[model samples]
Target chain A: MSKAERKAEVVDLKDRAAARQERLPVLKTYKLFIDGKFPRSESERYYALTSANGESIANVQLGSRKDFRNAVVAARKAFPGWAGRTAYNRGQILYRMAEMLEGRRAQFIEELETLGASRSEAETETAMAVDRLIYYAGWADKFQQVFSSVNPVASSHFNFSMLEPTGVAALLAPEDSGLLGLISVVAPAVAGGNSVVVLASHSKPLAAITFSEVLHTSDLPAGVINILTGTRKELLKHFASHMDVNALVYCGSDAEEIRTVQLEAAENLKRVVIEENSDWQSEERQSPYTILATQEVKTTWHPIGL
Target chain B: MPRNNAALAVTLPPQFVPIDEVGIDERVSRFSKRSIKKSSKVQALKLALSMLDLTTLSAHDTPERVRQLCHKAKNLLETMPELPHVGAVCVYGPLVKVAKEVLKGTKIHIAAVSTAFPSGMAPLKTKLIETRQFVADGADEIDMVISRGKFFEGDYDYVADEIAAVKEACGKAHLKVILETGELNTLDNVRRASDIAMHAGADFIKTSTGKVQPAATPQVTLVMLEAIRDFYYATGKKIGMKPAGGIATAKQALHYLVMLRETLGEAWLTPDLFRFGASKLANDILMQLVKEQTGAYQSIDYFSME
Candidate 1:
């Protein structure tokens, strides 16, 4: 064969290999995280997510009320077990979550950037999320000690107060910093020994779902932290009105939404804590009060000799 | 004894209508997919509430537990005084008297689980005495388990004769024959057992003893429902169906009702012709009904734990 013909054959083989590599990339399907498993919406509905430049990013699950109900059931099922664990074990698990997130730091940063955060903002948010988990982990074993009290009653009886987990918590993560916002809300509730069903930031949900992957592998029990990706406007009422939720944490300042939550939460008198328009990255956002928000105070009186 | 004509001679090589497993699965799937919405959902929940046989057949059943169950059966929810009483309170033979004293003057029937209960391994003479004693102790219904071992040994006639004898001992009490379809193994066997039970004078044919896995599944319920329909057509006797065990959700109870409505044409929708031998299912139905009334999901914590 001629040299020209051999060179042409080599070029053709390279072109074939390039074409094979250029086949459509396999995309990740963002699904609802319930009971530590990734499940698509039971309603079989999906919503398209887009970047700031109007470029389609991905199709994310549009969770239904039924999904919310199922998540609550799982959360309630996990509550007793999660709450019954020693605070030290829970703290260890939370620290393990931070370790998992740190191991996958690059992946989360890339995910946040793809969802439209700038590089610096994505890096800051990812770092804060890991630190926030560690912060709550430390509080898991100390909050009760700080909040519980030995009361001195006038009557001849021994009285004392102790903090207990407020059972299932329903949280609506802030719409701004998806990663840090979700971590801030979830860490406190779980560290206090309460299971949670959280609705992630509607626009930037990619990081929140990826964070669930961290929790899934970090020894966090299934259903202790269920994260769902969906629009807040659609799920706000269900999050507020579900009777099984003993506490609710909503991060926004919309008066109408707050009113709806307060009014509907009265159906079962769910303890609600609203953080309005606060910057999530501030040092003040990492307070132990966040953990106390979902803890119930139980006062016991013991009969004693006068 | 209200003996059926088919009981006169037990047919050897008994004729059982073969169940189309695929067809049954398809039909059951459709029933579950049905949209029972708005006012219809409320009505269905209420109907299901009335059809429940609140059962407590544990080996550790105490008189106090039976009494508590009877109270729950009579007054489902004190807060919701508008709800109807459960159809029956099902207990062990000895506990029937305890349940009867609590449910006396109420329309709720007391059903006793007899014939060695979950195992059904006792002698026929002992079973007869147990049934008669339960009836004399004010049990309005007797749920008897068929000898599954005899059925598996191909002794169809012994199974038939045993059921007839139990029915005679029942006297004025309604007789519900439990086939324990989970042990029967196949849909064909479930159908054959349903036919044998119906022909031997079962006022209601039940699916389980609540002690086995894979109990009262949609496929088994469907096969039994079809058998009941065919028997109605041939002998003009409308038999009842009770799919006990594992039917713990209101959605599942509604699906069974849908299957019953479609297969038997609404004639067997009444409590007299249908029953649910369930304990947890009552709370679920109450939760759904309360959710319908108040527009919020409910918690098991708020309901009685019978």
Candidate 2:
């Protein structure tokens, strides 16, 4: 071809490339966070996410039951290391998570807004989620003190009951308050040293995926908190029935879902904590008692000197 | 007939067996993808369980710990009484008697690692004495480590001679020559060492000593299994295969079994012809078996920690 014709072809190609760059928006592929790494669903399946007004968002990973099983395995593998950490150290890490979340406030707010929340509501939810993390951070080192008791026994023995974190916990984040509800349930469980496999809010999962980024950077050990974005209806049964999960914490009070969780959990006799139709944004939601729900009471007796 | 025929020596010469690294990786990946579910999964798990040589080779291992491991090998999860006992209990030479004492009445053989174990750095005389002593102390199997240093130095004959000497010292006890493929560095070397060990009269060719990184990987295992198959084809002798270290999951154990069956056929799928030298693999197989039975995943807490 002639030099003039070649130059014209190059110019046309450059123009099309520029137009493509401007027209196509860069979208984040939401994936499951298991064992501290971001991986697509094991089944390689995805579901299209849409906003309240039918505006298309992006395709999110459709995690299968195998994903939940993998998360449980990760949580179980990380339980001993997480639970073995000093309570003060756990508190510091939880506080650091709050700090990381504060740094990502703008990102979370934008995600919430894209999910159909108003600017002010997104701001409030992000702030409340950060504050909720701080609330649990403070409770991390003090919950055992409040829950423990020196029992008075009739025998010549010294008896006392102390609180220990339950093993692996499976959590279902509330469908409404995506960010706040997730932090409310997760912060408490991790603060008490229970590693968790959480199913993020089905309708508002953008903030949850972004929140996992905050957790990734906060020195919280991997597998201590695994988050999966998928339909809760499909995953809740496996989450509750997994024998490796020592505790099941369901944030929503849907009668049918609660019944399924309770029934499946009976197979392993797991500790089931149901928060029915609870307002995660309420002041009552942030407390030490939330941390205590995933803890077990260990009573020990020391024989006195005769 | 003599275990090591004169013709075997001619075929066992250490020569370059060029390995296709890409081909091995591709073949090994397929083993893990096979869906052995339901009754097949349960059968594979039980078969894997029966092939386990539950091992504890730590410096911290004591007589009490050996006794505990032997007990676990004999009675894996008392709640599941129908489960078959493991193939053997593997321990240090000094601990073999301790394990033998606990596994007295059971079919579980006591396999002892000798010849300086993880590091075959001792003299030939020392290795023979260790092997003979363990055999005299009631060990039914002797897992001897081949000299990796000599093998790397192009001293193929020395490596073969050492394995032969150790095999002679083992007398009637089956000899499992540990190639410790982790240090061997290449699939070609793994195949070469496997060929050398088998020719040197290794009744069983093992992958690791449970003390090295990158042990018993699928690629290395496939190479070793292929070597064993070629050797069997040439000599009409079935040499057992043990991919020992780093095989801690039930799924991985199943994968190894699949590779073995596909490579060497079902004739080698027995405790007499195959073994898994692992401490954690037994419980995982038990957990999988329990899951298959109850239709629920199991917790490690429900099983004993050996």
**Number of the top DockQ candidate:** 1
Candidate 2, residues B158-193, lDDT tens digits: the string is: 787778778778889999999999899988899889
lDDT for each residue of candidate 1 in B229-274, tens digit (9 for 90 to 100)? 9889888989999999998999999999999999998789999999
* Angstrom error at residue B176, model 2: 1.9
Clashing pairs in 2: none
First chain TM-score in every candidate? 0.95, 0.93
Model 2, C-alpha of A75: deviation from truth (Å):
2.0
Q: Compose the digit string of candidate 1's lDDT tens values, residues A50-114.
A: 98789888899999989999999999999999999999999999999999999999999999998
- Assess chain B of each prediction and give its TM-score: 0.95, 0.95
Worst 10 residues of 1 chain B by lDDT: B5-14
- Model 1: residues with Cα > 4 Å off, grouped in runs: A1-9, A21-23, A154-156, A304-306, B1-16
